[model samples]
Target: MGSLTRLIVFLSIFAAITLKSNSEYLLPITKHEPTNQFYTTFNIGSSTKSPVNLLLDLGTNLTWLNCRKLKSLSSLRLVTCQSSTCKSIPGNGCEGKSCLYKQQNPLGQNPVVTGRVVQDRASISTTDGGKFLSQVSVPRFTFSCAGEKTLEGLPPPVAGVLALSPGSSSFTKQVTSAFNVIPKFSLCLPSSGTGRFYIAGIHYFIPPFNDSSSSIPMTLTPIRGTDSGDYLILVQSIYVGGTPLKLNPDLLNGGAKLSTVVHYVLQTDIYNALAQSFTLKAKAMGISKVPSVAPFKHCFDARTVEKNLTGPNVPVIEIGLPGRIGELKWGFYGANTVVKVKETVMCLAFIDGGKKPENLMVIGTHQLQDHMLEFDFSGTVLAFSESLLLHNTSCSTWTSQK
Candidate 1:
């Protein structure tokens, strides 16, 4: 090969490597307090950059939006049913020549909506591992467009659901394929204000948490394989105030799944066990019990609970999971354990999923707030930082640093 040709090939390869190494995307997450739903905003369109807010849903497969409300985009193209993209999508169907997709609304009300698959330009912020760099266009980003009825049960302004499941048509898979980046994403859902959703990036945190110049310490656990496409992990035990709950071994057999949908939902038996244990612990702590609230069975007087930097000084709830060495525990402090419903009233944040529930335990957004969760699809493992509040930091801290 000629010298100039060799030099050009080397430069091309070098540029590709540099781009992949620093190609991280950031999406700011906002918490809707009233609905307890979390959503993120990004620009979608070609000629016009229209900002669309979407709920961050780990259960749904294909990302869908109320596209009828969106103005016509010059770059929008329909995916034909015979295309390879349509074939790869789970539960895909055909409507004439267009690729038809039916997506279950995450809100559960007005259950499912069928739409045609479409691709358009979407804009997102790119980062250089640690800092926000510039706006980048994701050309031909594939998503489905739903009608107005699908918007029911969804918080207003939240145009649609951003599917982050393990399915082929998930937002994570599409982004990974488009950028040739790591097949992983991290979420730091905030209790209030804004947090961050990072796509294929090195996890970075502000000091005290990272003064040693390392990623925040995370407990690694295997992601159990399932046809459901939900992120499931094994929970060996549950503890209140460091004391293990006397749960039937079979109760933990189903495994616990992580969700962005609802607050912690435990099976009837499991909920009874946990609530009973927590009540006893609270009694010992001299925390006064109040009348139970609607969704929550255990209510307490917020005035009686001591205040701490981390949150209300309540007994820590720990979830024990299988780790590389011995078992690892993810603990939830007062910030994540209890929610204040009214003045002087706070209740345990767990909800009863009733008998014969689909999953034994579904860890919800309430317990996940202020904590960093890395979902590594390539590794089939989840790396988690228990609570940022414990480190005098929060999910918002990551965005503020940028």
Candidate 2:
């Protein structure tokens, strides 16, 4: 009886340790309204916890921070030029003995910034699949230390950029290596208030989303690899209110890239087609059009548009992608389709990226808000929940829960 009791206790202790080690990490995402950018904050220090707010960039390779604001530098360690860590980092250089890393500012304000590849203790909250469990310390967290000048165009409080791209020195890669967990991260961008960023493990949400029988379905599409490490996915066709727009096949040959930096940018021709189709549909619904906004061509009088719990009652935009069985369509409802730039004005949230742009279409952060996007690097797939608002919940709903 004594031996059996000891075995049970030992198993229990082992299970606890395993659970803690494999637990997912959570970061709260805050939307900077003026810039339409999203950022996540975490602590980086050994003796003390100093909060660092970083812009979430899906295309950036290396995570670079303004070390000038870092309070505790006692635990900081610089990578040597000869070390394997330095060799693993792309665009690495040697500045004396310390390894140098060159990172681009996602905002395009500072094209290139050189920094030292460094490691330090960073802390983040871990969850027990659904709720917050405890805070865990990640030792030797890899990141680069950039100068103050590199923070141009970033939010006043933001000190750095968190790279979520598929790079050797990306935040996702380092976290996966440190925790020995799956190489996946889920981003829930909120239209307002706060959202949640889950790293590794299963993604859990509240009532409707968590319910197995009645939960909203997710569309899984392939994530095409790019030389620049940007997340690109093939968008076969686009429809505005169930009517497909006539687009040149060549226009979509390059595929559409997901960006957290700018607003949705479509090739001039594609934009015109989408705008015209949407305008016709809006007119049919008795929606009045207003003068075009700077970036958005389709602005409408907010008073004329009806409002629902989801958002402004506007035409749904569907992005069609290749699915295993057939074509999968990710629908964007009013909440994700239109943005209120003013009290009386709302606009179709898309920008015209002139002719010959790098990627034919770039889906931006404004359209991504209130949607759940899971980037699974191991599977090379992107599983997306079209719009959380459709399920009578927003990304903010997830963060508000305990």
For lDDT, the strongest prediction is 1
Candidate 2, residue 343: lDDT: 86
TM-score of 2: 0.93
Q: What is the lDDT of residue 91 in candidate 2?
A: 85
Number of clashes found in candidate 2? 0
Whole-model lDDT values for every prediction: 0.86, 0.84
Q: Pick out the ten consecutive residues of candidate 1 with the lowest summed lDDT.
A: 203-212
Give model 1's clash tally.
0
| Candidate 2 backbone collisions, by pair | none
Model 1 CA lDDT for position 289 = 96
lDDT of 1 by residue, 98-160 (tens): 999987777846777798899998888886544567888888788999888898899887999
Off by over 4 Å in 1: 1-4, 129-131, 207-214, 398-402
TM-score of each: 0.95, 0.93
